[model samples]
Target: MPTLLKKGLALMLCWFVSSDLYALVILQYHHIDTETPFSTSTSPDRFTEHLALIEASGARVVRLEDAITRVAKLETENEIGPGPDAPAGNEAFQVAITFDDAFISIFRTVFPLLKARGWPFTIFVAPDLVETSAQYLTWDHLREMQRAGATIANHSLGHEHLLRLKGRQTDDDWMKRVSDNTREAERQLTMQLGGNRPLLYALPYGEYQPLIIERLHEMGYTIFGQQSGATSRSYETPKVHPRFPMGGPYSALESFRTKLSSRPLPIPHRLLDPLLGHAETRPSLSLHLPQSLTRTHRINCFGPSGALTIEPVGEGQYLIQTPAMLPTGRSRYNCTLKASDGRYYWYSQMWMRKLANNTWWEEP
Candidate 1:
């Protein structure tokens, strides 16, 4: 009724609405066992703590598909706040849990916990390994999980580094092989899981080049990468939708909370394409940050070694040169900045280096 009281209420509502506009994070997991190589595994106790923390945080845990659809719609329609179909109290921070590789631990461990909470998740499976690998989930196991509110999506046929071309494999041959591999996986999944699943793709080993992404785009599939950043409406296409990996050291509660609150750093669309380091194995990256992120002084970039060299290229743009040619493995360059709200804005790009004529790669 009073003018001053009405103005105060309006300001609070505006703050709430704006904050909810960018409230989304996608977390990727691999294994949840203490015995299965700690690099990709998180101890069961830690995993339990993770779920408990999410439950107590007052944040909604949504299905991966729901989060993706909402973000795509938000970017296209430019609508903010809860939509007409949105449920009550959904206009807050949200998270989507996704597991890759379809490890046995998923069905044995992670699936049960998620099921108990009545939460939804997505699992990316390499169809070729379903029955071949003893450690992987079998078709029956996956089918049961799917029946229990899980989304089964394609990771690839064999989960090979999709960007690496075999010896004497020409560009055309590589393209055909990749296309066939992807198509075969889709066929296999369709035969088993029915035709109602979403065409979501998770890159194997978190590696990809611009051309590979372009080819995937042409094939009509939604893509997700293992880069360490928060996904948002700005990343409307699957090509650049970054999902933070949550395993091993990253599964700790403190780090998990920080990552859960992370925001997507402003990266221009043209400059956001996947950059691959071919012969050099280590490539420099240039970024043109959005003007809204004026805290340039707080921006920091780091690689596998440590802090990287960040040199100003021009107004609101910087060049990050890697310190060394990355070893023959998966490495990433991560950038984070201090947001006005005290949470960090994050962005990451992954690199997969291959040895030249190296026997290690030729082994069966």
Candidate 2:
């Protein structure tokens, strides 16, 4: 009887943990060179080691497009069976590998390594950079990589930040910019490769306003962000997908290991919602907990000021009744749940005002 009771407890804990497990990692890379200011560039040897580590860990390397498709299928309002390529079991984890900026080294070095391992990756390219022999990927090299099983996606024409430019010349300026860039890239790629035009785009520098995102969507491009988080069925948003940037000075193999092994960290409340203002009105969030822990579990909603204790309403769901209305300015907030089983989960998001106009705008 004692052994039976222990097994029951273990099963209960597993259920509790699995109930909230929703995350998928997406790793992003740019150049893999060895130059100053580009120290984040992975040497060919280090790159090989990285691939070996991923292989040994038994992690699946998916393309960015595949990742998007999986998340979209999972986010469907009503779906019975698993979408294409999803694991038979719902608990399986997935990781996607993506490269941005269409670096020459990616074609020469990364492509060969991935081909040998039979791995899939997505490369976001700036069409203008192709065949220039000017510090960017050439069309010939890109075609070779694509033939080797890599998917090439759009990253705009000049790789410029699409946000932060506004006013008089904005509308005409941005429409031309977006159209010319996207069309030229699409035309060149189609003429050369005879494949479907890439419908996905990565925001340069991960900076974009709501207007910019809307414009990209209007242009038939699914937007991707450089935010640090994990993708999942629950957290599916076309305009703000998560990506882990892998080309920073502080990013080492150990760091990569930690990223691969650990789950996505929750966004801190302070960073999401600042204490100085009221900015939570735009996107109000609530936590719904399972009924298993009616008496012992509590939900804590944290902000820049401090923790806001939320009282349980029903089952495991908690209601946060703010003392003051959320401000109109930009803000962010984080949520944490301390369960009776001694485990917790964290999440955060930023809330900001939408743009006034719907017209296209450029980053000048």
Candidate 3:
């Protein structure tokens, strides 16, 4: 979109903003087939229903890179000054739909659906898998999608877990290899697409430690994670933007609506926990939330194992912990506050717990 048109559209969105900040919901999926792994696949029929719901909600379906740029601008404007910039009521939502791993189902099913509607979307692909695996997307499919308003971005070469070290690999070697993988993936995307592609990367299986995130940041990339939350002031700006999964059991229409209605909680600063835990799988999390929310006592934090107890420590800092240890692999601590309106202000901290030997238990 042109700069003039983009600004005009932003003015016309008329969203329900919280704390003078605009929000964008990024929804991600892997497969669009019923035959693929159920945990990572949304059937074609369910996906169609999801699109119908999105259209009904009157939300703007934008390409991935454009969504981030819009949010960045909104955040900057709100930070500088605040006023009647955002309306005091309901309006259309802003959502960016993305598919990860570039499965054939996306090229076959998802492409035609969105193409017919002439709506824009994004696909995060591991270039190494293109045409190499029958289940994955081919370069021709990518070219076709790219021609039809789809933004192709990096998902790392080989789609391997960045957190898990290979056999006999040293810590330094692993970090270097991971960084290389990311850079090479982006290079391949540019080589294949032959356009001014952005350095957008989605973590393979959404696995990353603080170190991995920092390395990617140093490389000048905007990272996307599989954590469930809205993108707004809550996100770490251009780094590690959280995305809601839209597959498997999470494919329910009501659940999707609730996520679309969600707002970013007030966590602009003071969350710096490295979500990598080994021995202490049941790790503790601390957050510095607004005192006004603590006073309301309506803020609730939950982990996948169970509801976590939010203990107020001091000076607007709260200790969040769950009784049950998270199962090996990825999990999240989700905090939500019911807003004056019916919708909830939400934030999620993604965690990855390795096995006792500090090795990932399962492959993505």
Candidate 4:
């Protein structure tokens, strides 16, 4: 009896430890106008309803910068200070509200509501668009929002997709197109706001290639992308932080709740691995599967020269042994899998670097 009791206590302790790594929801908004074809533009009344739902959820609303700062500090020091106005030890349930593009409506509509509630938010602006057109926020409006505690960030100069540049362009041309634009935008934002340059960047259209991500990192940006899902310990990357797009005509409170209650979409291993550039050096690869797969599944990793196969060792886990002759360097690899239910999944990521040891270690 005592042995059984001890085993039950150990299982409870394990559950407690696992539950401590709660997920963070970063909600993204763009435009907040009534006319955009995009389903994400939330009307003012609907946005307020969304806010009311968030409040009812008992989640603390934080700015994207604040959320990033909290995550970084937690990673570095293993602690997050008490959130402003948050209860002690309740930081895990925090949410970050972010707006992309300097829409005039955001300043005229959203900012007032946020300010009234004393809520924090992050706004990404394309410096070139500010104050130029009726659709975009003017510099005065942006400054007013900044004064009201909304953190402004750079969203590039022209909102161009950095990854779609012509392949024939010279390295200098590419750098000017990407780096120079960001630099100038930074300069303008600092000059207008009279504060330090914004460090956060939202990828245009939620699109980013690996090279663009590297360039943004070089330009001192620590966060990017528009992929939507709750962030947990396993999904850590500046290029693809999960953020649910909110505040559109279709962004009713019911829809928002449904999205929040849903589990993350299952990203295929084939689609995920190549983005990391791991195919060349470690010819073999493994994927962490969702918990519901009770039976083992086969994962196939294919390279230019040959193919390798992996099998699930346990639920949502697979192992692959690679060829010793696999050359080292950054190479894109593709993965495909067939589950027992006959559904096929595909994904890829970049493979870079070869480790001296093959032993598995826990990822931080």
- Strongest candidate by lDDT: 3
TM-score of each: 0.85, 0.65, 0.86, 0.66
Task: Write candidate 4's Cα lDDT for 1-364 as tens digits.
Answer: 6999998875544443233234356778887767864565777667788888888877788777666666655544433332111232345566778888888788778888888889998888988888887888888888888887888998888787564453469866776678887888788899888765458888776655556666777666865556545543322343555566674443767657744432222333122422222234555556765443323545566654567556667666766545544544334345555534332333344444433453222221
Residue range 213-323, candidate 1, lDDT tens digits: 666767887788888887666434436578878777788788888887776664544424444434756578888765445433467998988888888877668898778
Best by TM-score: 3
lDDT of 3 by residue, 233-322 (tens): 523433578799987998888888888867666564433445465877677777876555556547789888778988888966888988
The total number of steric clashes, by the backbone 3 Å criterion, in model 2 comes to 5
lDDT against true structure, model 3: 0.76
Error of 1 at 320 (Å): 1.4
User: What would the TM-score be for candidate 3 when compared with the true structure?
Assistant: 0.86
Worst 10 residues of 4 by lDDT: 80-89
**Global lDDT of each model?**
0.75, 0.59, 0.76, 0.61
Best of the two (2, 3) by TM-score: 3
Error of 2 at 36 (Å): 5.1
Top-down TM-score ranking: 3, 1, 4, 2
Please list all clashing residue pairs in model 2, or write none if there are none. 131-138, 272-332, 273-332, 278-327, 279-327
